[model samples]
Target chain A: MTPIDEDPPPPSPAESLRMIAEQREAAERQLSPDPLVYHGPWGVAWLVGFGVMFLRHGPGGTVLVAMPAWLPLAVLFTLLIGAAIVSGVLAGRTSRHVRGRSSVQGAMYGFSWFVSFAGMGLTLQRFDDGLSPPNVGLLWATVAVGLTGALHMAGGAVWQDRLLFGLGVWLTLVNVVGTALGPGWHSLVISLAGGAVMLLLGLVLRRRPAGRPNE
Target chain B: MSELDPVIHAQARLRVVAALSALPEGDQLAFPRLQEILGMTAGNLSVHLRKLEDAGYVEVTKTFSGRTPTTLVCLSRRGRLAFEEYTAAVRALLPPPST
Candidate 1:
């Protein structure tokens, strides 16, 4: 018969506490939210949604000759909403697998978008009679950019993530440029430039190895 | 002696509680995942987990994700409160910080 191995001596109380402290530190590092998980999908959604809106409303003011202006807006709304739902589900599932903290943070982030967009819609309705179609579109674009920028910045600050913070600053600048240049230029920048940036970010995030810290 | 929780005083159990406490409320870690993180053998981990379960510090769920059976462990509200109390007691017992 094989002899049984003897158990090792238990650690001293002080040693055990110290081991716990070390483990805690390691766990904290492991538990922090990975940017790619949330940001990748988020960026893609905005990119596609905004890109479609830009094509319809840019300087030329109608890419599809047969389609009505309202159709473009409708499409944009559908795409954004669809993206949000899909991304939310994906984030939830991924968090479950990884035991990640980003699920709550991502939900809060989505809430910010809902509030911003809904507020803009309500404000527009209040001044519906006074505002021109172009003016309304511009207001929509500006609000979207502003809110997105602010939310990203807030996320960056909360998470201490430089990439998110940088993206926020860039998006804020895009808003400034869009507001200054008018709706056509604004749409062009957001669709082409902003979309590209977001898409690039998504791809980069997708490629990043799991369990790696953003820092 | 007065500061530490008797249930949480042991090294393995303390590690288990600490790991669970780090997770968000309602989140559970699979037994294998917890074992990997805590660097313990399956049998050892199970024994410690059973101890925690008996103490009302953690709740374990046996569920299948597809065909494979999984044991997921989560800290209960009681467990969280106890951990908090234990930490506070430990802190109170510590010496004042030096300038």
Candidate 2:
């Protein structure tokens, strides 16, 4: 193994004892939480919040005359429904590595979300006449939201939690596809499909890991 | 190989060897658990573990009982000697307690 970033200089024995006490105190705080219930609901709440925000705006102004005013509602529903499905995945599979690894994985997921959004942004500029300055601004905000999802996922991964990783990937795909379709048919289909997939994945993640200790 | 003396030799391996030497037989600690107990991170714990294994002062066992892999550290006969020597050195370093 590559040698660790140089070994820390040894503290005086008394100092070492103090440090040990501090670390133990911190770890105790982490392990003391009701590991299953606490983190599971925490993950669920985040996804629910994401879903609520997507649906609250009640869709954007209609682009096609033939399309009903309610078309935006359909789009919003797809996104929110997808959010609900994936939140289940996040809560179920993310418990083991929650302490140290989740933070790093969450950040990485955020970066991936941005990269995917940037790709979608350039794609949107190519096709539609309706792509106004404000619309472009919305896309940027979507990109930021995607980044938040990614960070949460990455953080979960670092902590050795699959739920976080699954959610991160799910959100990244949603943003990428949502952007590529330019707020119309493509985004709707992708969101619905991804949400369905999350529903399935949550079932698998929630099961007990073979031979692992109980939480 | 680096030249080594019996006395200065065991100084570097002191803390970890001390910790493992104190454990009851067959109970092994995972890296993070050791880190918490010893107030060290995985990196620090692994480093000392490697050194102790090299000197035959401790035996390192890597195995997975489940999804998470485990690193088991145990004292070897030779390690038990080095630890005894180390304890002697530490005692030697200290002045006797006043009666």
Quote each prediction's TM-score.
0.59, 0.31
The 10-residue segment of model 1 chain B with minimum total lDDT is B1-10
lDDT per residue for candidate 2 within A4-39, as digits (tens), equals 334442234344343333443444333322333433
Q: Candidate 1, residues A94-150: lDDT per residue as tens digits?
A: 455443245566667767777877887777677656788777788877877888888
Error of 2 at A176 (Å): 1.1
Q: Give per-residue lDDT, candidate 1, residue B70.
A: 83
lDDT of all predictions? 0.69, 0.48
The candidate that achieves the highest lDDT relative to the unseen native structure: 1
Worst 10 residues of 1 chain A by lDDT: A1-10
> Which residue pairs collide, candidate 1?
none
DockQ (Cα-based) for each candidate: 0.15, 0.04
